[model samples]
Target chain A: MIKVLFFAQIRDQLATSELRMPSSENHNIEMLLSNLKARDSHWQTVLSKTNLLVAVNQTISNENSALQSGDEVAFFPPVTGG
Target chain B: MIKVQTTDFNLQAEHDKLREKSSVGAVVTFSGLVRDINQGKEVSSLTLEHYPGMTEKSLTKIVEQAKSRWNIIDCTVIHRIGELKLSDQIVFVGIASLHRQDAFAACEFIMDYLKTEAPFWKKESTTDNESYWVDAREGDLKALNKWSK
Candidate 1:
């Protein structure tokens, strides 16, 4: 399972701490985001905007990055982080 | 030095720790607190989130960048995470230098980069059922662009 995290505005919208999703050996970052949105309308709406950025395992990432079972994916809106 | 933690830090203790030599004539520090309002809405509380291992890494990188560009004697940054109430300190940045120029520049530089590049997230609960987390400020990105070569 891949651990997914939401941050900032994304965290507020989700209203949950984290998510665990089953992944095949062949799962990718793009697929993970799409699947989450597909399952939850709130996730879909928060991620629907183009301003959101994703980070894989702490560093910023693109959508096509490969995913492993233990990887963590975080969603952010720009950097307003600190 | 950079520290990202869930524990609250004392501003005076941090300032004293970084204040070492008498040659360091100027000290510049910035403290960010959980505010009670944004855009006229009342903020009852705020929750800060971060990447477990990456937040410190990013802060170190920013502090390093400041040192490279300025002649700073000492620099320290502490950013808090987890639940917090209004007026609680959220983050702190301090820079010590031989002159005021480097101290001021480095302090502002650290804050500018921290605002746009760090991985911390805040979830604010308002008076109503609706809560909102702040979005990145466009001005912050513009400020960072000035320093990136």
Candidate 2:
């Protein structure tokens, strides 16, 4: 399972917070995003913007980056990180 | 020394902590404040957020980098977190070195890198009933690139 993290106002709005989903060899970050948006309407609203950043582990990730088992996926609005 | 805390810090006291006996002839500091306005948005307060463990670790590394790159005597960095009001002091960086040039240059260098490399995030709450996360400014990233080792 892959670990997904959250932060900011996004974290403020969460209920259960963080998740572990079955890892798939064929699915990349783009697919994971699509799956997340499909499962949760809240995610759809927060991430509908194309600018949302995806980080595999702690580093900013490319859309096409492949997901590996035990990877941590963090999806947040374009990192306003200072 | 470096600290990331929610308590408001005394600028002078923190500075004095680094004033121990040594050959250091210069001391420099940089403070970041929560301003009243930004691009016409009337900001009433600011909140600084950071990844707890990662932030302290990154800051320690940054201070070490400065020590290696300059002939410095002492350094102190204190950053405030949680809720802060308008004109409230948010962050402070202090550097002491043998010469003023190294002190000034390294202080700016640390500030610039802290702005970009550190995992801290700022959100501006305005009187107009809007809250938005401050975007990482392009100029800040550019500033760090200029001093890239």
Candidate 3:
């Protein structure tokens, strides 16, 4: 399974801190994102934000990054801490 | 040392920790405080949230980058999470080096990178009883460009 997490405003908006999904080695971030966006209109709107940030396995990653089973993925807003 | 905690930290203690080496000649520190006002709104308090594993990894990477670019002898970073009131300390960055220039530059560089690279977010509650997540500033992104060039 792939562990997906959300934080900050995205978490507040989605009301989900985390979820687990069955994963395949063929799955990449973009495909996972599209699968998430397909859940509902609210998910679609929130996940579709242009500035949304993603990380794979605790490192900053882009949508093109590949995923594997048991990998951890996170989606959050741009950082604002000092 | 890098730490993310909910409790407040001592500035003098952090400074002393970074300046432990006898060869260190200068120690520079920067602390961020929760402001009473932001963007014309009267902020009453701030709540910080971070990804547990990722926050540490990102902060370590930033500190490593600073060490590589400067003659840093030692350093300490402490970032406070959870709710914080006005005047409360939010973050601290301290760098020690053999010269003042390296300590100062590395201190600022770590802060600049931390603002954009670390996995932290702030939610501000105003005096009017409204709360909202602060948006990331475009200027913060631009801050990184200066270091690259």
Candidate 4:
């Protein structure tokens, strides 16, 4: 399983902070996102935001980044911290 | 040093700690306060939320990057989470170096990158009881690009 994390506005919108996804196939970040979006309409709408940001293992990541079991993935809006 | 805490920090104590090394000659500190107003709205308070483990890791990396790019002697980053009142201190970035320019540049670099790369969100509560998530500004992303080239 891979650890999926949600932060900031995404967390508030989805009403969750983290969850575990079953490991299957050679899914990349994009695939992971699509899978999450399939959960419900609320997930679909919130995850589909144009400005959505992602990270893999604490590093900023993109859709093409491949995922592996045990990896920690994060999704959030663009940061506004100082 | 990097800390993610809900409690407010002491600026003078943080400065004293950063400047303790004899090699340090210049110290630069930047403190961010929760403002009373934003975008013409009277904000009553702000709720700062962050991913716990990742927030510290991201902050440490930012400080490491700053150390690599400049001749900084030491650095401290403290970010507060949870509810904060108007005008309350929210964040602090302090750098100590042998020269003023490096300290200044490193301090600014950390702040800029922290705003873009860190996983933090601010929700502002207006005086009228309406609360909204603060959107990331275009200018923040632009500020980070200045450091890349």
Per-candidate count of clashing residue pairs (backbone under 3 Å): 0, 1, 0, 0
**TM-score versus the correct structure, for each prediction:** 0.81, 0.80, 0.98, 0.94
lDDT of 3 by residue, B1-149 (tens): 99999999999888888877899999999999999988789999999999998999999999999999999999899999999999999999998999999999999899999999999999999999999999899998888888998
DockQ of each: 0.62, 0.38, 0.91, 0.80
Better of 2 and 4 by TM-score: 4
lDDT of 3 by residue, A1-82 (tens): 9999999999999999999987963399999999999899999999999999999999999989999998999999999886
lDDT of 2 by residue, B61-114 (tens): 788888888878889888888989988888899988888999998898788778
Position B10, candidate 1: lDDT: 92
lDDT of 1 by residue, B59-99 (tens): 88888888889999999898988889989998999999998
User: How well is each residue in A1-82 modelled by candidate 2, as lDDT tens digits?
Assistant: 8887766655565553488877873268878877777877887776676656666776667779998788887765533432
- Compared with the true structure, model 4 gives a TM-score of 0.94
Best by lDDT: 3
Candidate 3 regions exceeding 4 Å error are none
Global local distance difference test of model 3: 0.93
Collision count of model 3: 0
lDDT for B40 in candidate 2 is: 74
Per-residue alpha-carbon lDDT of candidate 4 for residues B38-96, written as tens digits (9 for 90 to 100): 87899999999887788898999889999999998999999999999988999999999
Comparing to the true complex, what docking class would candidate 2 get?
A: acceptable
Which pairs of residues clash in candidate 1, taking residues 3 or more apart in a chain or in different chains?
A: none
Off by over 4 Å in 1: A8-28, A35-44, A68-70, B127-130
lDDT of each: 0.82, 0.76, 0.93, 0.91
What docking tier does model 3 reach?
high
Give me the runs in candidate 4 sitting further than 4 Å from their true place. none
What's the iRMSD of model 1?
A: 1.7
